[model samples]
Target: MALTPDEIDGLRELILAVYGPVTEELLRDLCRCITAAGQISSGDEYKLLLAKSLAGADDVIADTLRRQTDLTDDAVEQLMRWAAEKTAPLEENESLRNIAEAYVKVTRKEVANVLGQLAAADVDGRVYPIKDVYRRTMDYVFREVSSGTKTPEEAVRRATLRLWQRGIRTVDRSDGRTFSVEFMAQRAIMAKMGEMTTAINEKHHDDGGCDGWEISAHSASAPDHEPYQGRQYSDKEYKRLNSRLQRRIGTLSCKHIAWPIKLGVDSPQWTNEQLAEMARENAKGVTYEGRHYTQYEATQQQKALENSIRQCKDRIAAAQEEGKLGSGELRSSRILLRQLNAEYKRFSAAAGLRTAPERLRAAGLGRALRPDGTLEMPRPAGTLTGSGGKLDVEEARKSYSAYLDTLTDAPEKNMVWLRYFTEKNPTEYMEDGTLDAPFAYDPVEDRILYNPRHPQFSTTDFEMANTHELAHRTDVLNAQGYKNKAFVDAISDASKAVLDNAEGFQRVAQAVRSDLMKDILSALSSGRLDTGFGHKAEYWAKNSEAVPLEIFAELFTMETRNDSDLFFVKKLFPGLWKEYQKLF
Candidate 1:
């Protein structure tokens, strides 16, 4: 709940009254003490001396508190709480000070009004009636003059003359109001307290991952003041605002405070069954690439796919404009677009959307009849390529043959077609193409893809990448006894022993045993690990489930780089490494 603007105005009015007298006394004490000291040259020196002076004003303090300003003790406490909540989010001392500075600036106008009243009282026998308003103080001043019981013109004239004497023309630039430092100090404290309260409330809700807040209006607040009072916004239709800009129970300055409401506590509307139903409807659990997504996660994944599809479309449009539509660039982009649209369709269907969940109309879907009744394949949109236009197939095949010659225990060269990607259509190429990994193996399809645009694609050591990808194929393809269930079971049994004996592998193995394996494998498969050799080594070694496939690839590359690495490779997988080396 937030304080309504009217309530805030009333509180400010009351606080101004209370603050004015105390402020005047404090200023008086500061001046007297500064004069006594006689040599305050610096700001720090002045503040130090001012602090000593304020400590001596016991009688003034008692008198200031004794004066009735219409604010109850409860109201004062509420203001303190408000101040705390506002400052609660600030963690650093410097950040808290910055917030305090902002509050001090806003409240300075009110401080100026109070100072004007005090100044007038000093000069004239009577004081000018004032409120802590920043703009149009004269309106309030004139209103006071007309409403007061006695000598309206006399009071106005005396106050006006006094103001003139001090050269205080406008409330904004009140050079005569010399007590700004003290005023700012008081406001800084109040602002920090309020900010702390905000931080506390936010931390609670955030930590719990709870939905919405329980808004309550002030007790004395009128019926028409805040209709939103006692309402909740936990539903999907209600979009939540950022915490600071979030609507409170009442308008600004209203003394309404909102508290975090745990789900199923005060919210009878949010039953466990309803939450489960929402999860089923919106976030229908999605499993992709061996990883499962919750309702929220599924929606987020769909958004990602949509974004990729859009970006791919933009790239396709740019390629057409550049007259590259006839090149492999267009075909590669179309291929990627096709893959993305397929995945997006699958996701949407799982989430229960109405659009047909089918493959995009592309080259593979049979031709539709022309208006003249001629049999024609419906060519891809915006394509200038002829029906038989081909990529540089011969060059890619040669590269694949050369790459295979370097592999020792690599699968048969012809087993997988090395489809050289001519255009790096960011969306499609490899499984984790964004990482720029040179090669990717699709085990289900038994195809090894070579990314021609990879940074290491043209390098002499490119065969190492081929070895890495080939490791995946070797495990899955029916080379000797490789593709059988028994082979996978044997690898699993062997991996258990290696994991038990390996240093730093047990903790990762333990993590893999828990529900964390999916997340770890996803990270590894996507190449999301931090860059650099050491980080890659640490990542691959730790992901125990992925280690079986990854270890061979990593060791193969390492052995190709230096023969010394073979000692460790043989030690790790004596039987497999020996067998794999025979293919070289």
Candidate 2:
């Protein structure tokens, strides 16, 4: 495991006290990796070559140092010996330390000379492709930081700061004490670092299937602190913030150069054909009457269009207020607004963001009432959170009733009754949600749910069950929307690939359920342990399980801390529990 900053600092001090002085090379390697992703180039390359030779290579580190560069075999051998002698056993003998430091002093001078020569060659040579290859290699290097620490989340953020040479994303900007120096170095490297963008956007180099780059670090972290290795190459809409470093306009946005650079194209004047070709290449293949619009160009046009829409709205509002516009102009203005929103929606998928339709729907500022006494989208009690509505039972029951009424118009509109119950202790509730029964949906009964016992009747339990039931309804509708079992099978392979998708949901299903369960538990027992699991069972009915309501009650009875609560539910509810247990 990687040591914490405090732990590492302590180790460093102790090593210095015992050994007199420590090897600067190991510390330097760590600092170099943290300086800029580019700084770690040689070390990373060395590690890769070492890995390739893992099966058998006589002194792989030495071999790598010798073959990958012009360094003599003897010099490489000497450095390797010094590194090995100094890297570990810090709590052991001290006499060898003097010899190792002597070797390091010599190696440093040689290293400085070699790096100087490489820098000179880069300044005067064709290093574009070579730099691109190096950046891609660094991308892989950062992707593996997960292997170094249990807190992969922290590791990812740390690596991002170092990789970009920008501020560490972990400390929330202002919360740094010991980490501030590292964060500053990280931020400095990322600021205006254009070469890295050129490397990632190399996808747009030939085929132009790019819009533009937007860079954000990703996290590959498991809850128990394991490495989360997955996708590394970012999607297209990500912006390259250091655009000044990468000075080309997008394909569509290149309508007229906002600013032009003659750095790459050689001649001061650009041909019409050349400009058009460049723009098309950047347009990334979305043809407009067979002429492709470059991604850079499209972004510029989209921004201009939005500005035009905003102007139209201002003009119309002013005209109406001043009594200069007729009813016709007002109606036309509304239509224009709709069209602008639609355009945003169209580009949203490519932009990798929520479509316009989603934004409008979520605002919930508009509504329609059903004949059945339910509001279609009642102003949701200010976005559902872990803790639910007004804690008064009467008001909560009313809110729950309103929520049920709203769902009544939900297409299946068939009366969907789901109840949930969970254990009084939330940790236990959480443990069960994650482990024991991670929601097994039985589509046959049209019931979806989760229930943990509640010690007392409270808003938290009610909120938990309500969210779970609603989610189950969504799951059912989604399954029904599938074209055929075979198509769903294919989608499952691509999405919820691991589960083989017992039903038509992706990896997101388990996640959604978990959050919903948390909300349910959060809504109950604000500052105390609940008594039992009746409400949890009711929630299981609609959110976690597809089993009959009774079987769920039986399952809760079979596996829970409050067995007496099951008896209480059975005594009160009766027949349904016995019938449900038979399904097994």
Candidate 3:
């Protein structure tokens, strides 16, 4: 088959237009999946990239083959009708019919083979290596396709030709199984004609021989065979012609064509400059959503959103792992994450992208903080909260589960179970004169021991009991002794450093350094530091034995209640307050 330069050029144009956008969209989806999985290395990333490309190729080829069959069927039917309309009817109609039928079957098999190869690669997580020249050809093909100017037929032809060229190029260097482009084109022409011949012969079996039918061979590439040019044969004779002269016509680099009869063809033949101009026309950017984006620019935007969401999820995981969920910084981080999630949702919706369901994890745990900037319970549905006369074990369990969601630690998750206990005497205060605290956390057992007595429940309050004990447990299970004497000593050292450098405090606070020190010391010793009278000496040891844990528990409780206790604590231990925030 001798295809004019114009037809080849038109075929290239059609293939680019059809395959461009489809391939681009596929690549974007694949990139997002890989980024979300946190696979960034070159080899691993490229493996997925290749898998997606193969899948894209399967789609491109499948669509192309379907379209090619439609066009071939139409072209052959038109040619057959034109031949039958002639004053002197021609033969070879059977050959044309058989070729069209065979072409469809052969191309369908080829498409299926490509799809099967891609499926195997996907299952094995393997990537085929692309040669540099083939990669460049595909890149150019994508650009032209994205330009959106070529017809579907041209796009399909160009895609098929490029891939065909790659195979032929490699086979020549390896085993020489396929000789040249002309040989390949000629073989395709023969296959189509052969199928058409078979179909026509089956239909005209009652007719003896091909009386009015004629098959002719034409080729500009084989001018030396002028004797064979315009050679006509009957339908039955055409079937034998292949065997008679198969060696010369079906060999390496042979460019030949067999037309059923008279042929009148007119197609645009582009000049070198005109072809260059056509390529320029196909290089223009596509417009979407009021903005123009090159294929590369659109790909970059897709990658940025995918990577940003992945990073946000990673941070949340890290904070949970470190058990710093209660800190002010982590509270702020959660707020930032909420904002990122909203952004992700909007971006994906706008781009018509689908995000993973895992992105919705911890949706209810938004930025909920107490007034003093401590993180609060997420309070997801089904968590128990209010008070009643008798203890409802199930409700208590649900409420405790909700509270536990706010904390982070092994003990907080596992051993810190809740149970009710009662004292022999129902007194408002312990014998030690400390107020009878309703709930006490047992360090040894890692449990919250609750006073179930009616008098204690009424006086102690539900939220207070829940928040205070959880805070105590957070200190024991997660924060450990980070809030203890060592922490206080760091405060003392920082205080000494600041006070000794009086100019520093003067600059930051605009206060007299001596007066500030005097105020802090006075407040620390005023017995007000021992605020919130509590039951059992175990909860708050006297004097210096009062672990920083008690002070933190009290402050956290006060913060949750929105009381002024946080301010008092800050004033009494200004140095500790400054250092405490950093420690947690």
Q: Judged by lDDT against the true structure, how good is candidate 3?
A: 0.38
By lDDT, rank the candidates, best first: 1, 3, 2
How would you encode candidate 3's per-residue C-alpha lDDT over 1-584 as one tens digit per residue? 22322322222222222222222222323222322222222445555754665566556545544544444444334432332222112345555444444545664453233222221111112223223322333333344444555432343234333232222211222343433222233334334433443344334433432232232232222224334434454445655665667444322123333433221222223244554443343334345568764433443455466445434433333233223222343355556656666666665555443332211112111122232322322222212223533344444543343233333222222223222211111112111113254456766666665544534554443444656666666667665644466666854564465556555443433331222222233223332222132333433335453445555555445544444234544664566766555544
Worst 10 residues of 1 by lDDT: 357-366
Poorest 10 consecutive residues of model 3 by lDDT? 421-430
Number of the top TM-score candidate: 3
Give candidate 3's error at residue 92 in angstroms.
99
Best lDDT goes to which candidate?
1
Clashes per model (N, Cα, C within 3 A): 31, 70, 22
Error of 2 at 165 (Å): 38
- lDDT, candidates in the order shown: 0.40, 0.30, 0.38
Clashes of 3: 22
Q: Write the per-residue lDDT of candidate 1 for residues 1-584, one digit (tens) a residue.
A: 33333434333333433443243333333223322332333456545654554455444444443441222233344455445344354343454445444544444434344333432222342323222111122232333444563243333333333322222111223443333222332343334334444445555667668776765532223323334444565633123432334433322334455656665666543344544454344344556678877544554577578556544543443233223222344457667877887788777777543221111112111122121111222211112112332213433333334333222222333223222221221112233345444467666666665544456444423333454465455545423333334433545554555545454433433333211222222233333332223224445456444544554444444443333335533564465565554433
Could you tell which candidate, 1 or 2, scores higher by lDDT? 1
The residue-by-residue lDDT of candidate 2 on 1-584, one tens digit each, is 11122222222222111111011111122222322332232566646643433323223223333332232223333433422332333224353344344444454444322222210001122222222323333344444442443232333233322222211112222442222222222232222112222322342233344322221111111111111111111333123322432323221111111111123332334344544454444435344444454444454455456445544443333223222212354456656766775665566455433322232223221122111222222222222223432223333333353233223112221223221211111111211122233233344554432222222222233433444433343334432312234433332233233234324322223332222222222222220223222234345335322222223322322222122234422442344344433322
Error of 2 at 40 (Å): 70
Model 2 alpha-carbon drift over 4 Å, by segment: 1-280, 283-292, 302-341, 347-584
lDDT of 1: 0.40
